[model samples]
Target: MSPARVGRVIRRCVALLLVLGLAGCGDAAAAQTGTVTVFAAASLTESFTTLGRQFEEAHPGNRVVFNFGGSSALATQINEGAPADVFAAAAPANMATVTGAAAPVTFVRNQLVIAVTDGNPKRVTGLAGLTAPGLKVALCAESVPCGAAAATALAAAGVSLTPVTLEQDVKAALAKVRFGEVDAALVYRTDAEASAADVDGIEFPESAKAINDYPIVLLKDAANPGGGQMFIDYVLSADGVRVLTEAGFQAP
Candidate 1:
């Protein structure tokens, strides 16, 4: 072949290879993007939603779908084979219920607080104040983490009183106070902070004894294991911690 012809042939081959290489790169990028369904505790709604947005922003083409509810209920769903990539529970006890999940890591801690109507109109002093005559109080069901924490705090405080209602989750309990259905509710400090416009979170000393540790793990049978692990990594990253801490979660 003439030298000019040989040079032209080489250029054509190089261009073809470049195109193939670009196509290969596109395929790999596509594989890395998908929706990661995360089943998380109700208390994590605000912070986890924020983290999910940040995660999606950092990983374009990827998505995060969250199912936020009571931790115990979430664990039951996971144990029953609900399709989920990640599980973040409000308590280790709930995390322990999952049969097939990566080793759990405590990501954050939350303490209980009395969520009262705005302006402290009830003059509720502390946990003991809930015992006053006709004082209605809402508490999380004992089966849920918030409820268990409330039980622990009440026990530690040595105060005994029946709540007007036992809600399924912290948010529901907080809602009781927000709607004025109850005089107060024992809820996570973060939940109260999230609803600051409607209620005031009253911190008490006994809450120290009942702080709940938040745990996260990737499900072993996750449909998108890689995406699951990536979301877990982001939750433990500095940026994730910043978001959680700013929202009243304590680093674990």
Candidate 2:
């Protein structure tokens, strides 16, 4: 081949190599992107949702998604092999069901409360007051972490009151108070505070027995492994603490 022809062939090979290099770089960038799914308790919905947004903004290349429900339900789902990277539970016992008390850490605390509709409906005062005759009350079912903690508090106080309805979750119980469907409902302080615009909280002495610590854990093989750690760290950070405190969670 002539010298000019040889030079032209060299230029064509150089352009092909450059195209392959750019394609490889694009593939690597795409592989690094993905969404992290978290299964958290219903009580954490507000704070976690806010925290999720903060996390997505901070980590630019990833997205954070949450599945919020009762602690028991969330734990059951995780244990059943749900595709989740993080689990933020409302109670240690519930966390134990999935994480088995090995790696979870308590990140915040909360206590039970007697929340009533606006105007202190029915003159409710304390735990003992819930047992009054003719007063409709709402409570979470025995299965949920909040319900279990509530049962412990009531038993400790020697108060036995039957709820008109056993809600599926704490928010549902609090909804009863917010809508005036029930005179009072036993719900977490955070739930009451979240619904403060619609209901009022009455702190009770017996609630001390019902205090709960929320635990968060990153799954062993998290799809978004580093994202889970970042989120957990953020929850323990200043911004996460602010959101949790504003939502009425006690400092851990």
Candidate 3:
């Protein structure tokens, strides 16, 4: 082979190697961008979404994904080997279901309230009013935190009002009233406030007996442990507290 032709072939091979190395570096950088998955209670929808945006803004390359539903169901999913970086439950009982979580921190507290459609068409004054003939009411199923709280509150008030429908989560119960499917529903105060445009929260005295503590923790099998811890820390931060207060959640 001629010397000039051999030299040209060597140059082409070196250039190809350099390009492949740069491509591998780009792939590695892309892999470093983390995605943190958070499983939270349905009542945290508004507050957590706002916090998620703030978290993304604070950490440029990290993304926050949320799975909002009943706390009990979320815990069950986590225990069943669902991939989750963080777990924020509406009640301790649900959080207890998941083993090997970092020490849970109470972030906020919530209480049940009677959620009625705007203008209170039924003029429902209190729990007793829910018992009025033909007044359709929606309640969370007993399996959920909100439902358990509602049951405790009702029992404390010595009021047993049968609901027309049993929802799986507070959001679902609140939606029933928001959509005019039911005259009223029992949901967290934060949930009612989040949907204030479509529903009105009626604070009842019995709610004091059923306040729920919201606990957040990093999961043992977290894919993005650093991001999860950052998010939990953010929730306990001053700005996060401000957001929770704005959403009508009481400080823990």
Candidate 4:
């Protein structure tokens, strides 16, 4: 073979090898499977956990991981560039913290309720009863969504009572009641329902004025955008709504 012809043949082979290597890289990227991280409100622990498992079951190669905390804290983490696929917040105010997130959708609504020890051991009847002097009370901090809602309800009812402790999230407030550390705590109706076996919920007309809307959105920097969207769609589906309803969340 001529030397020039040999050189041309070698050049073509090198080019072909380069193209094949690039194609292999693309294939590897497409085949990669990763866990989807979800940041959600503390109040969503039970329902979201159940849904996360269902999501993982539906997506065989993918996993669902959750970070549940106060909605405000989760929003802050997302805004600070946390690697999260989805964010489900308990209030619109907290959702607003994350700029550039996909348009948020209101998935459910929640109302504040007074949680007391099981069997009405304290004989607490309504919001007024929580004001009794020396009655230990736990409340979410005013900065958290649940605490803000409690404040709204109290204001609307013309009732003001000092809480013995201010917690960072609804779950913490509920925990106080569950542990018998406080006589009562103001928490979401869903939270109260979740702990029904250990506590009783008291309905008050004031809760109507402080209903909270839960919003969900896909993070702009989601590592698994497709999976995140699928999870969000499932949560908005009829089956998901049924689960939320059973957990005591009102329809949005």
Candidate 5:
């Protein structure tokens, strides 16, 4: 073969190899990026949404999809084979219900409060105030973490009152107060604070008796376990704490 022809063949081989190497790198990068599906408590909606945005910004090509609801309902969904990458529960009891998850870690704490319409139209003052005659109230169902906390706080205060409706999640209960469907609702301080523009969060001493510890874990069958771990790490980081505290969640 001519020397010029041999040099041309060498250049073609080098270019082909470079193209193959770049293609392989692209495939690997694609494999490392996907949506991390997180099943978190309803109370975490606002803060988690904020954190999800930050996470996606920091890790280009990755996304966070959240399924927010009552912790018990979330646990049931995960235990029944729901496809989720992470589980963030409002209480450890709910977290314990899921079987296929890594060891759970308590990330934050939340307390219940009396949520009333803005300006306190009902003149609601404390847990006791919720029992006034002709008052309509809303509480979470007993199975929900917020409801369990409400029961404990009401018991601590020695107050007993029937709610007009029992909501399945903290946000639902808070919505009752926001929409004027009820006079007040016992809900997480974070939830009440998030809707402060439409509702008033009234703190009571009994809340100290029923603080709920929030726990998070990576699901064993997670489609994006690495991304789930990344999110968990971010939640435990200083930035995550700042967001949670700003939303009225206490440090774990």
Candidate 6:
């Protein structure tokens, strides 16, 4: 071993160590200041995405992201250890499945509406209208908020129908009407309103008994509490309720 050769080998080892250290630091920083992912109900897609943008703007240091699906599915993901900062569910029962009975503010309430094609080819007007024989109807699957509410509304009206299909979520249920695949679908009034340009929504009296409340919360695994809590607060604020109300959700 010559002294010059030994020095060159030592220099290369030092350079490699420095590169590895820098890479680790970059990875750690990325993990520390990451986007806050929210597992949310499908019905909240429009409103939550709208608020997600506001949250990012309000907290420039953090980014807000959403994973929207059925409330039950969202709960399953959270319970299954998905990295989530918050969970917003269409029903408290669904939220409780993952978050437990911890106090959660009811952010909004949604009523069932009959979503029909833009021209309403079937002229479906109310809950009773669904009783018409041979009329195809689309309702959210039993596991979804809108579907549960629809069932309640139907029970309240003493009317029943053989639905063409049960969709996975409110969004899919609404699509049946917009695509003209079914004559009508039961969905949250807000969902129908969100697609007003494409579908017609029929309000009915029985919806009162079937209103489902939406609850939002900051999850236990939140990476960005600053942005997460702020987003939850905003959804419960007057302005947020106004947006929900305008979109056909009731104030909780």
Which portions of model 5 show Cα errors greater than 4 Å?
Answer: 1-31
Predictions: Cα RMSD each? 4.9, 6.9, 8.7, 6.0, 6.1, 10.2
Query: In candidate 6, what are the lDDT values of residues 1-252, reduced to their tens digit?
Result: 999999999999999999999999987654444477888888888887887777666556667788999998888878888888788899988888885424677888888888888888888878888879889898887787778888898999999788989888999999888888888898888888999999988889999998898888887667666556777877777767776777777877
TM-scores for all predictions: 0.89, 0.84, 0.87, 0.86, 0.88, 0.83
lDDT of each: 0.94, 0.86, 0.93, 0.91, 0.93, 0.82
Q: lDDT score of model 2? A: 0.86
Which one wins on lDDT?
Answer: 1
| Candidate 4 structure quality by residue, lDDT tens digits, 28-142 | 6555456889999999999998988886776667788999999988888888888899999999999998877989999999998899999978888889999988899999998
lDDT of 3: 0.93
Weakest ten-residue segment in model 4 by summed lDDT: 27-36
The number of clashing residue pairs in each candidate reads 0, 0, 0, 0, 0, 0
TM-score of 3: 0.87
Per-residue C-alpha lDDT of model 3 across residues 49-87, encoded as one tens digit per residue = 999999888768889999999999999899889999999
Which residue runs does candidate 2 get wrong by more than 4 Å? 1-33, 99-102
Cα miss at 44, model 3 (Å)? 0.3
Residues 57-147 of candidate 2: C-alpha lDDT, one tens digit per residue? 8767878889989999888888787888888998888888884334998999999888998889589998898888999999999899789
Query: Pick by TM-score: which candidate is best?
Result: 1
